[model samples]
Target chain A: MSDSDGRRGATRRGFIKGALAAGAGAASAGAAGAEAGDPAITELQPWMRAFGPGVDASPYGLPSEHESHVRRRYVEWLRPDTISAVNFTPIHQLDGIITPNGLCFERHHSGVALIDPGRHRLMINGLVDTPLVFTMEDLKRFPRENRIYFLECAANSGMEWRGPQLNGCQFTHGMIHNLMYTGIPLRHVLDEAGLKPGAKWLLAESADAAAMTRSIPLEKALDDCLLAFAMNGEALRPEQGYPLRLVVPGWEGNMWIKWLRRIEVGDRPWHQREETSKYTDLLGDGRTRRFTFEMDAKSVITSPSPQAPITHGPGPTIITGIAWSGRGTIARVDVTLDGGVNWHTARLSGPSFDKSLHRFYFEFDWDGRPMLLQSRAIDSTGYVQPTKDALRAVRGVSSGYHNNGIQTWAIDSEGRAENVEIS
Target chain B: MSRFRDLAALSLGVILAASAAFAQQGGKLGLGRPASPDELAAWDIDVRPDGLGLPEGRGDVLTGEELYTGLCAACHGDFGEGTGRLPALAGGEGTLTDEFPVKTVGSFWPYLSTVWDYVHRTMPYGNSQSLSDDEVYALTAYILYLNDLVDEDFVLTRENLPAIRLPNEGGFIPDDRAGTELPAFSAEPCMENCKDRVEITARAGALDVTPEAEER
Candidate 1:
């Protein structure tokens, strides 16, 4: 092996030997009982001794090699082709509210469309006094607004609707991301094309190969929608509609039409393919709930989840997660340690923007006993997140979309956690 | 002629009216260019449920069968039962209320416009929007025939397509979550001793369906 590789291997072996010396227990596991003079802290580390790469080596940066495992992942069984499928965000690995543009989840009807901004045009037609077409340059001329919002797929926790199915929080609750979108208000743009008297609905269409379409109410179109051109303070990523995308704040991600090409104002709702064939919540009674645009309050414990188990066992255990509400901001989050036996209010950390993700943390001493971990969010609208059975009692398990029920994870005394449905 | 004079006057008035309407609505930006008729026609792809935007086309079930088998049968079965993980386009007509609802195009879709618009806009999987207007009609007709909505010899036209009501047309209700769900979901939740007992009824690690995940 190479000299550096040999040294690194030796270092790893030394770490293992030190861990064995510390006995069959966690490695520097807790504050109360940590092994003294750990080699990692006491010994001269290679990173400290060596010179890293020059700044010019990487014009654009990526996560450290050690963090390569934190990435967007997908279930092969979900769809046959990658072109028309979904991938999940690595929510467990994230800390703050803003999801890095690279780690954001992606759902493609056809596939990501890479378009030249110079060639892209957004058209406004139908039931307007004057149909108007705006070039990308022209769209930039209009006044812009920035707002932080969470875009969640209606089927975020779809696999777990029947019961606890997907093991990780990343799989079960990762079809969502919060971002600060910079763009012109959709109302301002629609006003530029002067809406006719009876224009009640607006159709947002994409320029992707699929040309996705969804009919939104005119009231919602004017309320808080935006034709966003950038996200997280940079040019939009191609997967997030790069040149342009429509932002229907607080609605299902599908309604936020990416790669936006057209907006047609009409008198009534057009029963488009997305509205009818998909996105609708089909209940046990066979009656589906159409135009169910807004997502309700939901939360998931990112750490201590199946994917993010407690590596450092016991004492000073920090249970953290993310919570959000499409209707408003998350007011409080209640975390239960012994299932529903006792509860504690988690500290809502970070900026809690309207309709944006709110991070929460509940710190407690881990008694090193088997426990059931759960988190529930309460929104500004006073909407309390319900239990799985309470949700199923009303909506039934047949519906895949809008599964915003509480999630429960069972952690063993060893600190390993798994997905489980409790009664 | 007087007729030509009247037409010219009417066109001038329409332009004036448009400018006046914009001014009244406080559309002071005037940033975008006026979309010409040709430009509007090119991008106006959506077809409403009332058959508003359907292009004139005609196709029979026989031609649709050929297209379906050639282009779609790989993902969706020959009889529209679905293949592997792809969604089924037909059947499952009465299973929506069942324990496991088999929601297919023929069973749950409320409007035929969705079938035509979806196929023309994005369909045939990888080769989306590749079908001619007539081909989309044929495919839609074939799907209907598969679900017993139409006869084998039936030719679907833009005019007749909307009239062919899907069996689940009346099966949909607008979102009533404000009245039904919000009231139930938005309540003072029990903080402690909420349940009589807690038991692990189901476990995901046991199911082992999580893709590429291990016990952490």
Candidate 2:
């Protein structure tokens, strides 16, 4: 290859694979590859040369430039407007847990709200003995709590029911994000409002143009609902809620209204449209499943998933993924290679708490043969994830929401992983 | 960079000196004395749950319907069916077990207090409460009627607002996780040989993940 000749092209798969194996950020891989195996060339491009000065950086960072294409892939086959409905995370390309806040997938019925926190206020009225309005500053004066939790849209894996509808974890599971939040306990505000003796349920409403609202059971409200003001550590990013969001703990993400403005206490629930026509799951019969509040235990393998294939095979491969249970802590996660026939307990690699994402890993040797991979999670309450067949038997396939079925990715002899319907 | 740092340090020193200088200048910093009672009143409008901050005024259902039709109906729907993709504010009670549960104010909401508070703080879609306190009360009553929670004769005066009960009012319970659910896993310890090392028995494509789409 001559320097002036366009005859040589940048190395493709090998360059990518080698970069990943060498544990280098994707951006540095191009130069690193040119210097690899050559001491003199390595000397020419010192490691520090790969980075710019500190001031040249950003307070918040993004994925490596080489990964510019690693974004939500939309299905042109699905809609007229790209933003209206489409795109997913590159789950296969991501490592560890904690989806970067920006890269987390988004599905909005209405556009993101640009709310001004100064003009924000939360009102507690209705059947309450006392009605109160708390400004943003007033809310900050209350006792606060911090929690790490994952919010999964009811439709997180809904498309998969039809088959391996989408490849990559981003499309399948990017609908979820985990983060630590700072907020006042929902119970404190309810108490301050002086709940009436008969008050039993509450309605949470957003100030967004959508006026998104939902009725919540009093038990769930008082139990873990959080009036969250901070996400991660800083103020909530506008898209996530801005000044305030109702943290319904382990419940569906939609019910956690963002830009929260009101709470009405009452004796019973008000079945808003959000709880009915939308989030509700339809059955095979002419019926629907309503108020399906609790998110059962679930787990998904992130790496070696559809997007990330087995670039290096047949060796000491470390399989990692996230497992969580809305009901409680994940008691155990079992990895099975021969379908469900053979099972081995995987190691919980990172923190595993109630209602929070738990990272798990399993190390194994692949014999360069085609392998079937699956992970099963069991919650503290002895609730084990059901097989696809088991879940469909109960919920039926007529519904497009709440599809928490077991997920499987098939690997062929070529080492490429593809979404597959094993059921 | 050095010059900038020096400037910052000088500004800090100036602020420190200014604080002491103000004290020497006596009670008022020339900005005026501590805020007066009237000044405090001008900025204070926090409404308490016990009816602490309600402004002087009142509204009824007829007036509320007119205001709602003018300001709210465009997005919330003329009858609260809700605008496209937006939530339907009416219908759906006792439908929790159904596949398509329709939770509306009449059918599912637990309290009337939320209606009043929400309207006062944020409502009328984009404009948000161009109405006064009396207008907010009337609009709340009108919405209650559309949800079938109230008749046309119903009124939502502050005095009667707290007395109104919602259907799902008693449906909530606190999240008492301690004695109710899982046993405390927080304990002394167990780290050593609990398990030596983990081994993988499976991969992703080999087993079932999603259910059969055509089966249902």
Candidate 3:
């Protein structure tokens, strides 16, 4: 394939090598020529001659039009209809840890519900000393805190369990987003209505058409859970449960109920459909596993992937991606170039918080050789991300949830990449 | 050491007295009002496995058959076998250990209350919570009958619902991941020569699951 420079008949490896050598020769010549005579200083640019757009052109700003390609995408054949389907975050295009509010992935059981916050009421009953109902204003009166955390669907890399099933990292591992949520701690709200002696579990229910429900242990609800009202510094988007949602840190995304309307304190776990029939992981044996929450340590290289291929000839290349663990903060990430033969500890960039996405980078000079790229993450809990074979050995191929297998990107001689399974 | 222990005991006694005063103040932040019984009844629709929240209703399989054909047959075929991407509700009894298991209700579900609760909460796909109490009961009975769990003449009620046990009731085990999996996976990962040779076992491009990128 021809490169952007229209270098014909040269292989990708040859093109990169030749370009690098030519670049070095040109740089030396340009330095000597600059000492002889200055030229670029005499040129005038159009931006310096013209006035830019004034402020207030857009009261609420948006990403530049050049960034229009960055968007959530869905596979049409994955579901029967869009109402109960899922769309993936554009993780390949993102650099930092925080995913933009609008570009966050969407997974709806019965589509996004447009609830009127004015009419919405949160009811807390069942095994509480006082059954209480709070309006939006009343909810705001309670003490609140801000936290950054990642919400990962249990089925994030589920398609890869049997084998590599999606060509892009966006499809295989993009069912997650990290956000800064502003909300009141659930303990504060639950304490407002005193817990009874027998309270053991909680039923967090949504107000959408599906009325999605899941039973959470009372201890977790009283821990780091939040009744979130805002995300990423602004009111939550409608698709993100505008008025309120539950941020069950480190748990499965489905347990973080959106458009939350009621919380029932219970004496026993509610074997709802989500917990009993759907989310349960079927095993190689004839049994199933329930309440398989908490995503394990996982990582994936975002760029230089199938969707985001290497365009420029190799020089100073930055291999960057994200790593996260539901159990705790990511302790370290190791990147391998030739599959898992040799590894280099990647540099962890940006703020590292518990249960939040951590950005990592491995900067190196590329010599235009093909690579078998993979990243393995280890969390503070000392659990390392397992290989696909290692994971299959334990959980079997029947499990469609919690497939935190190490992903491999096969880079060809053309610097183009594709998803493949390695043994 | 005894003086230090006496001082610590005194401080603990004072803290207990302060907490007692706070408890007497009714744990009130004075934010939300007590919910009326009617409001609680309207939003509290969760059904436990013990049939705690089921409404008073009874429906026979014969009535369920008519209702299933009329209401559920559009997405879930006449025999509870799903059409398109809709979930299949029956006929996957012995397929759990197969290469590609069909985890339908009769085959994988561990509780019958979940079947009734799911229908009452979010069934008919689009028109959720639109079924009457009796209709939900009838649909549950029909689905059970479709899976051969119940006979055609069987009737379902809130009282006898919890007594019905699913075939896979004993198939579920609580998540032992922390105890079973954490130790095995917690070992220090090897850095060099983790494997002798790497081979491409499979390619996702060959599967053709990903959609083609649109021409920019």
Top candidate (lDDT): 3
Query: What is the lDDT for B111 in model 3?
Result: 82
Top candidate on DockQ is 3
* Arranged by TM-score, best first: 1, 3, 2
Candidate 1 regions exceeding 4 Å error are A1-36, B1-25, B213-216
Which CAPRI category fits model 3?
acceptable
Clashing pairs in 1: none
- Model 2, B188: alpha-carbon shift in Å? 27
Worst window of 10 by summed lDDT in candidate 2 chain B: B207-216
- Each model's DockQ score: 0.39, 0.05, 0.40
* The best candidate in terms of TM-score: 1
Clashing pairs in 3: none
- Write model 1 residue lDDT over A164-230, tens digit each, in one string: 9887888999999999999988888888888999999999999998898889999998888999999
TM-score of chain B of each: 0.83, 0.61, 0.85
| Model 1: per-residue Cα lDDT over B105-156, one tens digit each | 7888898888888888888766777899999999999999999988999999
Q: Which candidate would rank higher by DockQ, 1 or 2?
A: 1
